[model samples]
Target: MLKTSTTNVVPEKKVEAKQRQGFRLNANDKYYASIFLGPSLLVLTLFVFYPMLKTLYISLFLTNTLGNTTVFTGLDNYVKLISSPDFLSSMSVTLLYVVAVTVLTVSVGLLLANLASQKLPGIGIFRTLYSVTMGVSVAVAAIFWLFIFNPSTGFFALMSGWLNLPVVNWLTSPTNAMWAVIITTVWMNLGFTFLILLGAIQSVPSTLYEAADVEGASSRYQFFKITIPMISPTLFFVSTITIIGAFKSFGLIDLITKGGPTNATNMLVYRIYKDAFYSGNYAKSSTEAIILTVIIAFFTLIQFKFLEKKVNY
Candidate 1:
């Protein structure tokens, strides 16, 4: 009886072990995973992946005024853009704008985040006030700044007249108009950067500060060595997205400068718009759009490769 029982148990154990060695998920897990991932996959395929592939296809064709394919042009559109003066100038302008916005936004946000992180009375109110711009849409913010920067009737006009100072045109001159757009973009993005860094700063362990205090570390020293390093991860994220946002900016440039005063503020996105609608060159526009996408992807890869290495976590 004992021998028969052992034989039966050993066979059952071997069968169970073999089943476990095979790679399989229970039916419930597969069902739940499908339920959770189905909509996102469908949406991405329909909206993002499909459109991107279609744009690549369209870029290879010559199109009529109605954007229908007229002929197969291959890479002629891309080669044409490479030699075009407007495209080259717009690429330069885009690089400048992206660099300016990313640097200034991150710097100011880090400064304000430190201020807001302090445990002072009514600090929450101050944080709320600073973050108010985050609630504003780009169109609304552009229009709001338009009112303030209007040379004849805006805030500068009102104040300059009162003080008898010569009024400076904020949005008309070529040099000033570029800076004006940059200022608006930075201000509009400040609230988002500040809030993200604020949370990162707050999450830092209190014991670290206490230890620094006991070691006679100065506030500046602690900030540079401890605070910055601990919050580097958030800084990396904010800087990356800020660069992308600056690259893709269109509405503010459209409303404020329209790439105007001799194309001083014209960036790649506005160039794409002009080619697509104003010039009625769908093939050229699609080619430019693909190039812009590649530029963005390249920079994003660089950031992840080099910049992300500095992040603490």
Candidate 2:
């Protein structure tokens, strides 16, 4: 009996091993997987990771016009960037621009989203109108806004003449140029924000609103308590994207102000571009680029940590 039991168990173990072998990836499976994933990996390495690593490497040495490292400065490039008054001013302006754009874009987007979510006549038309700007490219939008902000032929100019009001230099004045950028950016970004928040708002169960209505909750109270909390995840996403976009704003500044009126509109990205391409200071530009990357990463991490706690999901 013992001999029979042992023989039976060996056969069962062999069968189980065969079953497990069937689940393992065969040669064909791995070949197909590689075929699908290889190109994407190659592209990412070539474009993203390689450039980042190269930038980090270049930040350590002063390079000549031909992109050859002439002197090993180590962290001296970073030190100088931090100490330079122009760099410091660019950082300050970048901070202000990021904050202004992020807040305005996200808030206005949520507002428009709330309005679009409402059940009303021609709401789809309104939604389409709001989202139309999303189809416009950044460069196109910047140029279009440039036409609008033109002191001679733009909307403001025409309005000022019609109303007999003083014509303000939208793109020229140091104090008002940043606002001009903000306004154009807000309009361009509103469509995306609206669509995202609108989807989030719509996903919220109407039963929650019904319950609130049964409890005599006011509209403002429902908005603050129900709408805000329920859509906090989408809000966080829009805010993060907006912040990053604001930091990397180049085409708008280039077309609208070109960091003019005494560098009032010069953000970090524009400054980096100017340093690298125009001024031929690759090391300094690389340092500034790395610094900007760190700043963006820090802010993103902070958002995920602090803002995430409030998110319902």
Q: Name the weakest run of 10 consecutive residues (lDDT summed) in model 2.
A: 1-10
Would you list the C-alpha lDDT of every candidate in the order shown?
Answer: 0.89, 0.88
- Please write out the lDDT profile of model 2 over residues 180-250, one tens digit for every residue: 88888888898889999999999999999999999999988999999999998778888888888888899
Q: Superposing all C-alpha atoms, what RMSD in Å does each candidate have to the true structure?
A: 4.4, 4.2
The lDDT, on a scale of 0 to 1, for candidate 2 is 0.88
Error of 1 at 307 (Å): 11
State the lDDT of candidate 1 residue by residue for 32-81, as single tens digits: 88899999999999999998988888899999999988789888888988
TM-score versus the correct structure, for each prediction: 0.84, 0.87
Q: Flag regions of model 1 displaced more than 4 Å.
A: 1-40, 299-313
**lDDT of model 1 at position 64:** 91
